[model samples]
Target: MRRIVQFSTGNVGRHSLRAVIGRPDLELVGVHASSPAKIGRDAAELCDWSEPTGVIATDDIDALIGLRPDCVVYTALAETRPMEALEQLTQILAAGINVVGTSFVWLAAPRYAGDWVREPLEKACAAGGSSLYINGVDPGYSGDTLVHTALSLATRVDSITVQEIFDYANYDDAEYTGAAMGFGVAEDEELPPLFLPGVVESMWGGPVRALADGLGIVLDEVRQRTERWFTPERIDCTMMTVLPGQMAAVRFAAEGVLDGEPVITVEHVNRLTAAAAPGWIFPPDGHVGVHRVVIEGDPRVEINTHVSHPLLDPTDAACISTAARVVNAIEWVCNAPNGIIAVEDIPQAAIMNGLMWRAK
Candidate 1:
């Protein structure tokens, strides 16, 4: 069993912790926490296990490094502290420990991260002969691996579009929803950072390029289009209320153009509820969130995937999938050549270990 330390138990990190505990081949050697209150707690307690696992959580980075685990599953938030995450990953790699992380998401394809982030990371990897693999749901499997795998069935390809359609009424992170994504705000106000020009392309374009490269096509240009819908009447939501004429939903599309046409495209359709936009795509019955890939070719293929459990709804399943995508790849990543790697280079992510599904 490979010794592993989990970092920052957040939305995705918590599930990563669960995955580490569930996998018999991975041993939990340490748990790194940013919160002072979380220090001195048992890893099993942090994960809500009925009994202790002998490994206690700590705030000391040196303590974790001292253990010298084979790999570090760094699931810290990149959107908030990208520089810090980069520095931490660099330090971890320089210590000769391979990494599988959800941070620095653009590192899902390292080259697209520009020279600044990639340069230091590559230096650290080379210095220690350690490799790093970054991934998540949308940026990880939905757009890159899932699309590329589905494309294999097509004899001739016209275009490929990967879509994420969800009703986010139950999604509680008001700060992230309103401030970062510009949801429930006045449409006339300046759009949030995510909707601003070049932001989505900067963050998500790497996956598009990764998928395009799989098809051996070079995108001449990458473009973005955004459209928003407004609420007609005040509606109460678990997170926030959508008042009359307020921002209700948004559609954002990033297209990779080749020969003056979009060959690879990724679209996100998020609604406050089904009523927000009746015309827009919503998950079929028995699902609330759907990650879909559509290939228009000789043998057209459209794959809709939804992760669900008895206790977890579609939204929770989405978060778990994000964590599980990279968590399940830790072994393959640690065994790969020393460098920054992508999903296409790694083995298939096997996530069917403990979760059961409802087939309809």
Candidate 2:
């Protein structure tokens, strides 16, 4: 069993923690808690598990590092604190701990994360003999693995598009939905961080490049397009409120260009509610969210994968899937060579082994 340390206790992190606890091949050793309310509590308490796992949540990074875990599931929010997240992951790696995380989506394609973000982590992995793999549901699977899987069926490839269409009405993160996503803001105001120039490329260019790399095609450049939909009336979401004439939905894409043509695209259609965007794409079968892969090639192909749970909403199910993706990679990452491991480096069997198997 791999000894694992869970960092952070947010939505994704919480799911990662429970996954580590539930797995027989993994042992929960320690937790690095970010919230004051979570700190000093048992890790089990943080995720509502009935049984205590003898692991306490602490904000002491050094102390957690000293636990000498085989892997640290670094699920801390990386978008708002990119550099800090890099440094933190570097510190964890430099301490000889492997990492499989959902943060640092750009790291999904390290070549595009720029030298500043790549060099330090590379040096850390070399210095400590540890590996790091970063990914999420969208950047992790939809655009990268799922898209490539669909491409395998095509005899000739023209263009590839991966879409993440979700309704954020039930997603209860105020800062993310309101501030980061600009969901409740006016269109004329300064755009949110997600819509800012170069941001989409920074976050999703990795997957676009990954797709290009898989196809053995060189990209000329990566471009972004963004649009927002206004709410007609007051829309009170679980976490934030949207006023009339405020931004309620967004449609954006990051395009991978080759010879001035976008050959690979990662697009997102996010709305506060299904009622907000009448024209934009919505999840199939009335599901709240879906990751769709559409390939325009010899045999035009489209695949829709929806993740949902009986107890959790569609968004939460996707969050848990994101957590599980990295969490499931822990053992493989621990055993792999010290460096940044990409999603393609992981075999299909290795990724599916954990999800498909059950204790008999």
Candidate 3:
């Protein structure tokens, strides 16, 4: 069995810890956290485990290194200190431990990151003879990577668009809900231009750009746009004051181009109140668009997917599923020809069969 250590106690980390613990081929050796409050607690308790594993959370990196686990699963916040997390991951890899993570944006597609982030990490891994891979449900799965995967079956294509829409009213986490969908903000909030800061684009921009590149298109420019709204009238859940005609909808769109011409568009929309006027423009009702990959060519194809509600729990199952997928691929990645890689670079058959094998 492969021994693994999990870093972080956040939503994704907790879920991945549970999933890895349940796997027969993988053993949960330890859990690490920077927070002083969680150190020395049983790993199971930290993740609400029914059975106790002697493993205790700790902040000691040297101790974790001594344990010499096969790999470390990292799921820390990517927006802040992403480079710092990557530096830590590189250290682990240099210690000859394989690493799987969702922290570094570069792992999604090393080419998109250019040499700035990828070249150095690649060198570090090479020096340690270790391997690293990163993936997640959204940027990892929902973006053009999946679209490009589907396009492999197509003989011709004109344009491709991928969209994800969901009702975020159920999300009670104020920080996540607010920042993610632009909630509680006026329409005219003097925010920076869309995609300039990379907030609205999320980390999936590279996936989209990579997919377009794989399709033989030389992308010249990309465009991003966002719209936000609030409850026009006071609603039960929202406390923000509003007499009427208040903003209550938000939409963010990103478009990829070839030769200054648009070829791909990725959109994310959220609605908090009744699905009304502007709300319709954000997340059109009828279906929760988890993923919509539309290829317009020959036998024009459209692929729609909906993540199971329980599996969609950002804290637990959703991230666990994605992490598991990434973790299970570690062995293959370690043996893969050197240099940077992406999800599509690995064989689809291997991913599918490995997932099935892990399930059993």
lDDT values for all models:
0.81, 0.87, 0.67
Q: Which is better, 1 or 2, measured by lDDT?
A: 2
Report the Cα lDDT for candidate 2. 0.87
Highest TM-score model number: 2
Give per-residue CA lDDT, model 1, range 1-360, as digits (tens). 889999978667777887787777788999998887788888877766656789889988888989999999998777757788788889999999999988786787776777878989999999999999888888778887788778888899999999998888877756665566677788778778788898788777877877777778888988888888888888787658888888888888889999998888899898876788778778877467889999999899999888887876567678888887777777777788999987767656443433442321
Q: What C-alpha RMSD separates each model from the true structure? A: 3.2, 1.6, 3.5
**Model 3 bad stretches (over 4 Å):** 187-202, 235-248, 273-278, 281-289, 309-317, 337-339, 352-360
User: In candidate 2, what are the lDDT values of residues 1-360, reduced to their tens digit?
Assistant: 788999998889999888888888888999998778888899989987778988999999999999999999999988788888888999999989999899888787776678888899999999999999998887878977788789889999899989999988888887764688788889788878988788888888878877787789889998999999998889887757899999999888899998988888899999987779889878888888889999999999999999989889888899999998898788788889999998878886786656544422
Q: List TM-scores for all candidates, in order.
A: 0.92, 0.96, 0.85
Model 3 C-alpha lDDT per residue in residues 201-298, reported as the tens digit of each score: 44556766777777778777666776655565654444233324444556777678776766887776656644534526433345443566788887
Alpha-carbon runs more than 4 Å astray in model 1: 349-360
Report residue 16 deviation for candidate 2 (angstroms).
0.7
Name every residue pair that clashes in candidate 3: 229-247, 229-248, 229-249, 230-247, 230-248
Worst 10 residues of 3 by lDDT: 235-244
| Candidate 2 stretches greater than 4 Å from native | 354-360
